[model samples]
Target: MKPTFIKKGIGFAIASVIAGGSYAETTESPVSKNQQPNVVLIFVDDIGYADMGFQNLRDDIVTPNMDKVAKDGVVFSAGYVTGSVCGPSRAGLVTGRYQQRFGYHDNIGPRVRDKNVEQGLDLSVKTFGNYFQDAGYTTGYIGKSHDGDDKKFWPHNRGFDEFYGFNNGAADYFISGRNVENSEESAHSSIHRNDEVIENFDGYLTDIFGDESVDFIDRHKDSPFFLYVPFNASHGPMQAKHSDLQKFAHISDPLRRKSVAMTYNMDVNVGKIVNKLEQHELMENTMIIFMSDNGGKPDNNGSINSPLRSTKGTTWEGGIRVPFAISYRGHVPANQVIDDPVVSLDILPTTLAIAGIEEKEEWELEGVNLMPRMTGKVDKLESRYLYWLTAARSAIRDENWKLVVPNIHVQNPRYELYKISEDISESNDLSSQYPEQVERLKTEFERWNEYNEDSRWGWNKDRYPYTNGWRGRE
Candidate 1:
């Protein structure tokens, strides 16, 4: 089975428009080889596409800093993460390879004391920090380090020169405590500076990350640095500062009001970092990439991915697709919206390319260097396939066509096909009318699945039943 000629033509037309024209014309390049810009990746946890003010899906939420980032950079309208969940999505971003390839297909559960399990990112793969460190950049990580807690899996060992933040999936904002039961009690969730845990931290976690990020920038302003700020603001254990909550008193729903407060707090902190960059005169040379790890879990966090279907742990647009933008004051064009499909994996390769590093054969990066297309050096990206797999479902997207297959236990255990180009909301399923397309996508997914290793750790069936696949509307 193959995509119809007309559908192929339509896909190419869409791609052409997204690239800003046919291959005949070009625009001025925005990159400079001599000046190696500092890289700052601001990765937020569980932020929905509509939550940010720049997305224009929600009028109530105010995120001025995030809005400014979009205004100053190129926004990818069809941006996505490799996974619909946190751990795998981050794994793909850091390594520039599908997490499935390394057996990280599911979220790493709470740490188990007895069983010997490799819960974090695979030790074999080199992270972005590793590459940056090798490239002579001072790499520092601040905020939630959900990758792993094992001594070997720690961020410092993973090539980051300095590390601060919890090593678990979620933490209490006001105070830190381990969520696991019958485990050796320690400051497991407390903020850590390098290896020492800082107990009873004075302020909100988000503010703490912002202050530390500014300090990191100030300390390394004289030299190039790679700072990864993965804030855990709006994740779970929904807690917000009293002042922030008071500001959002008009919000009728308590959960939503709290979430908005947390978002406001995050935005304020982002502004602080931006101000620090300007003060230190690093704003122009620093390439800032801001994105969420995955879509929000509305049920758990009161996030709304408006106009998109499903949420968080699903293959729908609301899950994988997210708010993504890149800003480098003098290099990247400002206030441009690129509708091309770009994934989180591209972050690693794009950053490396901007840093004047050639792709090494040993790196095996699945993501492409987006600089050419981004700078209008290339009209369109070469066509590629994007695949996602979890224990309960699998999905494959090629060009504009997307096919999702849910586990038999799911409420609607059937194949879903959508022309995502025409229907971003995924309200229509054309599988019944386009069996050939479904077969083609399914075959592509099967071939890709063969390249992936079986998950090292399986999802707990008792905790999350198969029937409860994704708690978002399709």
Candidate 2:
């Protein structure tokens, strides 16, 4: 399963065009050894690949703050997440290990009170909270959580010193109390401030989350802190404030207009966080990372992942591939783009490396440190193949070569292969033309898949809850 030089990624294509006819870890970093930078990771939910202005995939969508982040940071053109959906993807990112390594391959619905449903992130695994807290840094988690609904799985108990957010997948942006059982339930759906149900301020949920993150930064600016803000913007149950909606009135499509307005609110909050960082003179000393939990789901939210094939849930480029960027002032070069394959798993290791911490093997982390690759100290990662597997769908990607096993529930399932670099949209099916490549990739994928586990409790899994659980698509 190891990827060697024999399997070339986008690196070779760039190398072929470079002056030396080769590529190496040659870019020098401008970071000093004496300082410890504040790490802020902003994780957005169900953001479209082409939605951000930085991606430039569409004309109607506008995201200035995210675009600015891309302009001032390094964008990974081939950035990927572990899962095409939520729970598993976040599990992999938080632990720095493949989610399958811990048997969390499906979505965990909103059921914190259901004793029969064993939901939430496995407490056995350490998260960004544990990593930074152990290193004497104040840690805060603010945003929507697909991790779990139970108290034990809550942020404060899982390494973060301060926690503020909701327990389920989606929450109403403007209101919470309603006759619907899913709304305003303190245990499962309502907003909470450090373990207690609290009313959201007179602003939208996205704005509230952003303000909370800004407050966290302001309170911790004097000390080294780690802030994880996973905003549930532009997700399902789309609702936008009148203020934002008025701005996007020109958008004729009602669904798209609402989606764009919601996203615009998210962008404004992101800008707020950035302005706070600059206000406290922590811009250069703070390491800011921005990315989505997974690709957009057009059917659920009016997200447009153009030139990306399909929407979320499937293992297409649109499902797993996402916009990933990092800004570290002197440490990371701005406006640089890394076309070589990289994944959400690399985030933890990269954070540890830049923070002067040694990633212990006892952790059994699967992701490689991305700082070296970004700094040109290393040209490529040792991991040759990035994999995503579940009961219904799975995929294996090596550089530009990708072989996808569509949902087994399909009427007639077949393997699909694509040279992703040349076919970004994944429109062409090369399986028939390259049977040998398909067979080879399938064989390798099977071998690699042997070590992973099946989905936890959704769709094909044995356990199931009343709502928010995975209901297979018709």
Candidate 3:
């Protein structure tokens, strides 16, 4: 059964009584000659394009603090996640490649028993943490951690020097309970600080992450740091402090009201960290990038994916498209918005570029350095065929045209093509009118898939189509 209004209201109240809010950060500006600028990646779960103030979301929702970052940095109007869901999307972000390329498309198995014995990032793959650590940066990860379910695959094992957050996708604000159920059978949904479970946290989860981030900076002020702040806010089993909910009580939709409150809390925490950066005079040297793991789960809350069709768990614009912004005072320009298409896979390369790391010609990385585009060194980003595929569907988008083949398991699936520019919501299908364009895209997708291997999902020719299964989607 769906959550009722009264149930949600009571949940909010319980969350409030247990979760308080108090935050503080470092004040000294410590810069080292050999140290690179501090990197802060604020990754919010299940937020949508219309959730932020700059996005002109429903006027009822408030996100002024996040708007401050957009006002001070370049906001990418057309930013996208690697996948529409959290696990694979995060895997792609961490590895700088499509997760399907490595067979990590599914969530990690439960903590108790391995339903499928799924593995976290293969030790073979390199993570952003590995790169940053190799470059001498002190890596710290705080808040929701979903990349791995097993303690062996924790953030500390994935290249982060200091890890303080839950191991699953979502945890309770104060109680630190695993709010969302994982597909894995034995996984326990609980909170942890380092390797130990947290019996009690003094404040809300969002506030805890922000305060920990500040402390991480204070301890590593003399050195370069990479801080990954992944908040469990706005993702369900909806919970937020009462003060935040009271601010949005006028909203009639109980789900949406809770969403607004959670988002407001996230924004306030963002403001807290940004203020810390300024106080330490490290704002100029800090490179902060804010993005969501995927599109919002509309059913879960008021996470809006307006002007775009569908929601989380589908291969639609609303499912993959998300709000993305980058801020580095004196480095990235203020108030610039890049509407061109970009993906989460590009973050690793971009961050490396910012930290003065250059890739060898033979490195074989998929993402390009976005610094040129962000710094006005280039006119625009290079265009390439962006592809999406899932067990049930497959799609390819180039420029304004997109081709979707739903129910791919069938022998003769109907292909529907649409001009996305003319129909941003994907309300129309024009496949019959443009057979040539459809064939061209289909052929391109086939060609790309031919050279790749289905590393994420073991090849199951009986269950999946495609000659070898190296396609972007399984």
List clash counts for every candidate, in order: 0, 2, 6
What TM-score does structure 2 among the candidates reach?
0.86
Ordered from best to worst lDDT, the candidate numbers read 1, 2, 3
Query: CA lDDT of 228 in candidate 3?
Result: 90
Tens-place lDDT per residue, model 1, 81-107, is 998888888889888999989888777
Which residue ranges in model 2 land beyond 4 Å of their true spot?
A: 1-35, 109-117, 176-186, 379-383, 409-413, 460-474
Candidates 2 and 3 compared by lDDT, better number: 2
Alpha-carbon RMSD, candidate 3 = 8.1
lDDT of each: 0.78, 0.77, 0.73
Off by over 4 Å in 3: 1-27, 30-34, 109-117, 176-187, 361-363, 451-474
Q: What lDDT would candidate 1 get against the real structure? A: 0.78
Residue 203, model 3: lDDT of 72
Better of 1 and 2 by lDDT: 1
lDDT of 3 by residue, 1-474 (tens): 211111010000012111222223445665654567888998999997678766754676567666766767788776887677787788888878877666664454322112243446777777888889988899998887775545677888888898887776666665633322221332435555666665544677788788888788778877788999988888987998998888888999998899989988987888777767766778778888899988888887678988777888677888888888888888888878776678887888888887887765554567777889988999788778777665456678876788877666688988888776456667778888889999999999888666554434323544322332111223
True lDDT of residue 11, candidate 1: 11
RMSD of each: 8.5, 8.1, 8.1
